[model samples]
Target: MSERRVLGGNQHALPASIFADDMSYVALGHLHLAQKVAKKEHVRYSGSPIPLSMSERNYPHQILAVEFDGSNIKAIEEIIIPRCVDMLKVPTKPASLDEVLATLKALPDDELPREQQPFLEVHVLLDKPQALLREKVLQALEGKSVRLAKITPHYSQREQQDSLQHRRLSEVSPQQVFALSWNKKFDGEPTEAIAEAFETLLTQVEEQE
Candidate 1:
């Protein structure tokens, strides 16, 4: 019987002391998938009981119940729990906003947990006029028990590149381009003076390195 060691499922092997005669079961965690390690029968990993992200939507949520016989491992049982939250990734064009809202409203409330339904991440693919999809979704879900975890807006680099192509080579300074690009990608006012200062500091540090 080894000392009970809880570890991530992605890790390999149990310590020698964990398998000692007087030791008990080793309960592991993480790796979002429940599994037994080796033939020892006592080492196990209990995955997340709920799907915390869109990538884990297919995984069943469960809890592990282990019974120990004194200092020896007896039986390990997996208990499946009903999912309290549902994670959905819906891709929509700008024109489909109304339809998307309708679909979300039509989702069965019975399937959702009473406490709070899982967070939903909406991926918006804008093919038409620009609109604040994030603000719209947040407003729609407001007061509702369900939480809108995030709204991701997808943009095409080709469209931006094509727009940039119209600018004359002489008109597009590297510093200006950098400032424009950085300001667009990140939320904040970026000034040429600040950019110059950062560049000076970066060059000084690089020289030291």
Candidate 2:
């Protein structure tokens, strides 16, 4: 027997009864990461031909070949697919726009065809929107051989801290609120400098009011 959507956010479980000791092999799909299932060597996910997301850029995609001899598994070998295009996340985390541009400018010159050029995703950490965000990125890519797929901006400081004033009043420190709010929005924690800067901003705002 076989299954699909075992990965890609699908939570359905693969039944063990299909992988009885008598079974020789099972081919699976819907998971971008190739992996074995049910601790059975014969049951496996073929994964996608290419990485579907930036998170999977590190590993090479693969195809599995299973040889069978008289309904018994003979061999399982992996064939690595050549990357025709690349998916890269610059800095791997939130960083200054200049730092991100610097990284982009430092990339090895891409002389390949447009389709072969790497797909770059830039991460920019800012306090507010930059009106010329796309223009700035394009300027940085001048004379470069790459496709700028996206510029994901993360706000380091909360744009509306006052909204949390009444909700989390019990929180003792503004830094604590900043950390919590960041986690709530991005599902991740802020760095020490980011938290401290937010605390300083909160203090300044209080003084003004």
Candidate 3:
């Protein structure tokens, strides 16, 4: 099998058909969801023990318990893992500064053990930079039983197009150049995390000079 269409999606790797004749059970990894491949109970992916990224927040993380009798899989059971800490995106979806602030402030304030603290990602729908917006969110999260992860600022398409203006190439910094190029190619500003990652890499390169 060339392009193996598994339970998740089509994988370009080894086709499940190649192991069809093999009597041994195949346990695979890499895919994030625990599932069987090619409708075969023997071929499975246990998936990650926890959510690897924000996109996988809703994924049910579990361990697959396979009972083997001789060379065949007798039974396959999914063992659900208890979530020690929750991952929360304030207001669920991107919201205005006021709405995000109110939701952040209204979060569970009870002081729990550090290990039990939920991971929080603050999502703010911004058309333009709000003065001290991140600072205000941090202030609101103060004394709360949550670990602040990152502040995600989603810019509107109108705001992105508004930034398209001619500027002297030499007058702009590397970050500005990157932003301009990104906006021109993709028509949107890079996320805060992406910008920070580029900055970090830039700093490292400069240090190596």
Candidate 4:
């Protein structure tokens, strides 16, 4: 009665409390990543047979076969499942539409079965919807064999900086706006030296005016 947990085939439904020190082995699902839960080797998730998310695509899907010696777990073996349909991400993270389109168009054709062909997930960093957006993506994939499963448009940190740049100077504080501009240029926070430099420039401009 130590390990009251059983193979949870569904995702995210397995409660951690079900795993106890006395349990010989546990098999769980719902979480897409193969991981040891609660720091117990006997407790684990087999993950999905195929990656359900873009993040999980790098790791191989596995099946766990657990052996028990008396009341203790002997060993846990992993059997890798061959991937049929691949899940891929364009531009990896949220990127400009142009970069995403270029990645999609550059994808080499894979002569697999239509059902086994890779599924692409495009992540675009866009502040607002563009005209004929889906059409543009479809056009890019015109000759590609990959299936366009999802097009996730995200408002990224770069987009925030761009928005600040477009805003009126009177609408935002000088320090805040300048920091945003600095982040946009450097891809990081403004340093103390940069802040002093900005302040010095502001003082000079004010005196000149």
After superposition on all C-alphas, the RMSD of every candidate to the true structure, in Å, is 15.3, 11.7, 10.7, 14.8
Report residue 90 deviation for candidate 4 (angstroms): 2.0
Measured by TM-score, the strongest candidate is: 3
Off by over 4 Å in 1: 1-22, 30-32, 38-40, 69-71, 88-102, 105-114, 127-131, 140-145, 154-209
lDDT agreement of model 2 with the native: 0.71
Model 3 C-alpha lDDT per residue in residues 1-209, reported as the tens digit of each score: 52223333323346678876666778887666566777887877787788765545555699988888888778888998988788877766678888998888888779899998888878788889888877899998888999888887766655644564455667556765686678778877787557646755554343223
List runs of model 4 lying over 4 Å from the truth: 1-21, 93-95, 125-128, 154-158, 161-209
Whole-structure CA lDDT of model 3? 0.72
lDDT of 4: 0.71
| Candidates by TM-score, descending order | 3, 2, 4, 1
Better of 3 and 4 by TM-score: 3
Model 2 over residues 74-97: C-alpha lDDT tens digits? 899999999888787776777888
Q: What TM-score against the true fold does each predicted structure earn?
A: 0.48, 0.66, 0.66, 0.59
Span of 10 residues, lowest total lDDT, candidate 1: 200-209
Clash numbers, per candidate = 7, 0, 0, 3
Ranking by lDDT: 3, 2, 4, 1
Please identify which of the two predictions, 3 or 4, would achieve the higher lDDT against the true structure: 3
Candidate 4 C-alpha lDDT tens digits along 1-209: 42214423343344678777677777865655567876777777776677655545556788888878888888788999988777877765567899888988888865667897788878787767678878999999987888888887755556666666678878866766776667668987665456546755554333223
lDDT (C-alpha) at residue 179 in model 4: 66
Clashing pairs in 1: 1-20, 1-21, 1-23, 2-18, 2-19, 2-20, 3-18
TM-score, prediction 1? 0.48
Using lDDT as the measure, which candidate wins? 3
